[model samples]
Target chain A: MKVLVTVKEVAEVDDEFQISGLDVDDGSLEYDLNEWDDYAVEEAVQLSEADDDVEVVTVTIGPERAEETIRMALAKGADRAVRVWDDNLADAGFLDVDTKAALLAAVAEAEAPDIVFSGVQAGDDANGATGVALAERLGFEWAAVVNDFELDRDADVASVRRELEGGVEELTDVELPAVFTIQTGINEPRYASLRGIRQAQRKELEVRTIDDVGLDESVLESPVDRTDMYEPASEGDATYWEGSPEETAGELAAFLRDEGVVSS
Target chain B: MSVLAVAEHRRGEVRDVSYELVTAGRRLADGLGGELNLLVVGGDVDGFAEDLNRDGVDTVYTVDDGEEFNHGIHAAAIERLHADLEPTALVAPNSVDGLDYAPAVAQRLDVPLVTDVIDFEVDGGGIEVTREQYGGKVETTYQVDADQYAVTVRPAEWPQAEDRGDAAVEPIDVDVGGESGTTVNGFEEVGGGDVDITEADVLVSIGRGIEEAENLPLVEELADTLGATLSSSRPIVDNEWLPKNRQVGQSGKVVTPDVYIAIGISGAVQHVAGMKGADTIVAINTDPNAPIYDIADYGIVDDLFDVVPALIEEFGGDPPEV
Candidate 1:
């Protein structure tokens, strides 16, 4: 069986940052593997480790700079990697859900993996829609916010637990040829060891353009356009305690005592 | 140019987002000069439809299906409803199940989808959605230039519709029984442990700012000094530094303590959802722009490492050496 994991390298903005046109200034941004996708990669890799004939392949839609993030996934245990990017995409200011699902659908059609894994949402956009949209495009089954699962190879079913709000988990069983959007805290994602990191350098990392993935510039067309980006005007009316640590702490202590929730 | 809003339910009760979708749908419908139609797919459809008929709703459509949410059934039912109604826009909750089916429905209909929209406006037959990015540090607006679109509104952003309306309750038969790719077995309530943080009057919560598992003692000492229960944001529980029972967020326990002292917590939307009801909220963090400040009644903008020790000293307690 083959598993395809969708990985993304998302940008984390600094506490104090500047906005440059449509996005955060490059100088104030830090790039890393998405926290949620890390869990998805580990889920796929663990599946590969538990079974005899399971093969893990990761697919990413990012620029060449994302190779570092892709390599991190490879080091964690993915057998190989496929990256889809080109100039047309780099110029596309905002890629909406349809555009992204179409791009991923093109790759999924070519690879045709038995199972697909993606993060519940990206840390940046947080759309939380691409995987289910991709599944719909491929006519495959899907489950979202899946935190735990037991895959039955023989029956070709995955008994999964979808984490809901307020500490409730819905149990469900999805048929094979399905997509599972893995949630965080599902499993402990292991760190890439020294040997794994060295081995990742030699792993096959294939780069393909939009056309190479059997698509053209038309895939970049979307109805959604990002108009503006800015730090939201602060709605805070908080009474700030401004002083040295001792003075501010004293203020908080006095307030807590006045409220009778704390005693000194 | 009507708006269709779908309601969600679990077990036997309709979720709060269902009512919130009504508020969003009514706003868009008013802007577009059309009607606002509501939908309840499964699990007590009649009852849910009655509850969802808010002041501005014109029609409530109910499709009686299973007792629980199965994405396969939900996706099929919603797609069929959209095709029949042909509304100018479709609105759903950005809940876990909403993420499951809204995207699939939008994909099948080939409409532009914008998820987790905190605010939106309809103008000249087009829509612009406002959403947060970089973990709510910044907000971005996007214009969707389409005749029809789908959007999921973030939960708790809009107030729940409480006033009942005089809308026509209609039962619509949607054929979703043949949809069998997935089956929802049942639901399980997790996070049962030694401590029930919900019962506490005071909660000292830590977040990613705590830095490492070894540094947890710093916050433990503060909680002890205040004689408060210990809780945390999702990351601390995700990191396994604390047990799942101690987690305070959307997926964790909803805590309404008398005093919620948030140390080093950035107050992500999920984290805020769990603790925003506290009577008094105090934040201690170095970042002045953290979302936690928006809801905080009192705040100290300083490194937690410095302020925590001082707070312990003010309470006449020795800070633990981490």
Candidate 2:
């Protein structure tokens, strides 16, 4: 089995993002493989390890700097990497949801992986739509917010355990060539090794562009627009009730009732 | 100029978020000095449309197709509507389905797509949207630069509109061509047996401060007494003490209940980002300076072990057996 993992370079999750002073186009902030995507890549690596014939390929879209993110995946044990470079991609305002779906569709067309994996959502947008869209585009089965997975190639089915509203829901006998969008609690991602990092420098990386995938730039439409960016005003000082556990609970319940948040 | 709000439903029943989207659309339409039109699409959605029309919609377009939701069908339907109605803006809830389809519609229309909008207003000539960034640490406002804009309104951010006596219902025939490339072979519900936290008016969210899985029952007891639901921060879910659906954070479900009770949660920005919209927030933690208190309406600086049991007892709820 072969797996294709989609990764994106996003603003470092730990960075203090400033809306007023920063340029939206200029890549001024630190970048890393989306935190959730790392888990997807790790899942792919685990699959490959579980099956010797399994191959894991990592793919990402960004400028040349995005290669670093792909390299991080390689260092984490993906067999190879692909970097779809377009320096103006982000500035083109082409990062909307459908463009991403189309881009992944194009990648799926070229790679033909048996299984596709991605984090439920990206750190930048945190919309959690790509995997579902990609699955829809590829006409493959899909499950979202999955924490556990077991694939049976012979049966052409994948059993997934996903987090739903109340308890864990088990999806058994799902068809294969499916897409799974992993949730944050799926697994703890492993750190890259120094040896792996050194070897990643020599790993083969297949680079492609929008044209390479037969997608014309004209087909890309961005329905959303940004008029201006400004910082949100600070909320007023929060009220605090300090007391013994019993007293505090009593006061808190009373306050909730007073605020109409709870019925008396 | 008119605004079009997309209505989402399952099994011919409208989701609560649809009402919220309509309410948001009415506000934006009013701001733009236009009328609010609602677009309902689904299989056997006529009854759903009739139910939706009670909200006093100026125009209600119903597309009753027997097919379940597909991105291609939804996109094509939206595109067809855009061509005919020429709405100034299109709005939907920032839900899983909306995120999947809205971007496709935006890409098809060549317009800007603003998502996770907490607030929106029409300014001089464009739409201004406010959204949270950096996992809720910063709130950023954007002014859209497109003639036709698409936005996904965050749930709970806007109040549902009051139902009007009646509304004009129009049957809209949309040519949703054959499946674009995807088909819903089947639909399986996520975790079974758990209540939807989004629908819960009161949520008792536990954090690492709970210490052990056994202590969760104490929180559950309080929730039961208050007729509330039990939820958790990411760490509790990560530790497998609670299901992921109950996880409240950027990576989990975003809930804005009437009342939110946080026990032993240190309150990371990611977690706070998801729940800051709640009407009233109460935090109980040993640390007086926990970040959860920064946004909490009431703070209890005490050990949860002492607090939760007392809460259960005071509320006439059975305390968990130690």
Candidate 2 CA-lDDT value: 0.74
Interface RMSD of each: 0.9, 6.7
Question: Against the hidden reference, what TM-scores do the models get?
Answer: 0.98, 0.72
Highest TM-score: give the candidate number. Answer: 1
Query: What clash count goes with each model?
Result: 0, 16
Q: Write the per-residue lDDT of candidate 1 for residues B151-232, one digit (tens) a residue.
A: 9999999988889899999888877757588988898999998999999999999999999999999889989999999999
- Tens digit per residue, CA lDDT, model 2, B1-322: 8898888875446778788887888888889888888888777666777778756478888777654555556777788888898998899777656765775566567566777888977887788788765445445667776778888888666777758637688887778765443344445554334567888889989998888887777888888777788999987877688876787875567789998999889776568867888987888887654657778877777888988887776666679785
Candidate 1 lDDT by residue in tens digits, A1-264: 999999999999888899999999999999999999999999999999999799999999999999999999999999999999988888886788888888889888999999999999999989999999999999999999999979999999999999999999999999989999999989999999899999999999998999999988988888899999999998888999999999999999999999998766
* Candidate 1, residue A184: how far the Cα is off, in Å: 0.7
Residue-level lDDT of model 2, residues A1-264, one tens digit each, is 789998888874332333434333344357888978988998899888898999998878777878888899999999898777564464575365667778888888788998999887787656666777677677676766677778878877777665442232434345778888886667767899999899989999988777787786753555444445544443535666667777877777677567665564
lDDT of 1 at B79: 83
Which one wins on lDDT? 1
